[model samples]
Target: MRYACPTPGCPTTAPTRTTRCEQCTRRNSRAHKITLVCGPPCSGKNTWVAKHAQPGDLIVDLDALYTAVNANPTRTDHDQPAALTPFAFDARDAITNRLLHGDHNLRAAWIIHSAPEAATRAEWKQRGANIVMITADQDTLTHRAQVQRPNQWGEHIQDWHRRYTLGHVDRTVTTG
Candidate 1:
């Protein structure tokens, strides 16, 4: 019941059912390989995920879902913070629930601002998820965001940038 680490380099041994060594596994099993692509709003998380992930990758897009719910296809009100939290929580729940189903063919990318909550990460890990983290700088994010939604205002972009930069989201990839 032992194996090698899949994270490239680091000659670490892991349990057969786990991707990390015994100690690493104990520490990380509670953490899922949930690739968090965090950056300011408009950071191209969607574009990056679309380009990088394969066909079966489940994309949990809170913005998209919100737009659909509000019937606002253009996302004209994304800057309104008060309007986004419920949508975010719903998206998180949806992603977590899907991951818990234990379907190996389900690869996924979530468009979230920061790393998932510990409980959510653990749920994904127990369901055998591999996490990866992707990020970009403020300038890159601002440009992408602007390009993606030309009609949106600068204040929106600045707000997202500030939040992301302040949060300091670190990325990691874990595979089971």
Candidate 2:
């Protein structure tokens, strides 16, 4: 069976066994459904991903991908933010290819904090995904993140609070 290439610029026929043609296979192999969970750091995105994603579900975590790209399984140094950007793009590309190919019945999530995230959310929705935005109040988020990691909440807590105050989050679902 043959399938159409999901990427806009690519003109190729994808096989049913694989969502991508030979030219795109390497990138398409990772394609799947994306459920973006955007919030401040420690906003339970990982917890939600763990809870909702099934066994075959793909998880495109920026942090994890960054660590993998850096070849550091244990990225203990929090100050090296610059080292993570390239890996983040690689992971994003992989995830985008997967979404285009529809290679797996994927349920994935992203923890974002910018306008670009909104665009990403729109793109996923256009792809016929069920976008569920999860949100919580500043105090609650701080409390949870503090419970999860005491020292890490300094910057992320303020960012989340600011985003919440500015109403940056859209189509959000408040959950306990």
Predicted model with the maximum TM-score: 2
User: What tens-digit string does per-residue lDDT give for candidate 2 at 1-176?
Assistant: 67776655668887664364675654344323455566666555666677777776666666665556675656553323576787677776876565565555544534332222556566655554445556667677777766655466667667645554332333566656
Cα-based lDDT at residue 133, candidate 2: 59
lDDT string for model 1 (1-176, tens) is 66777644437776663465654444344335445554445545566677777776656666655655674455464533456668767876776555443333444444354433444334334444453444556566566656655455456666644543222224442211
Residue 62, model 2: Cα distance from true site in angstroms: 1.1
Model 2 clashes, total count: 3
lDDT at 158, model 1: 66
Candidate 2 minimal-lDDT segment of 10 residues: 107-116
Q: For model 1, give the RMSD to the true fold.
A: 9.2
Per-residue lDDT, model 2, residue 131, is 57
Best by lDDT: 2
Clashes of 1: 5
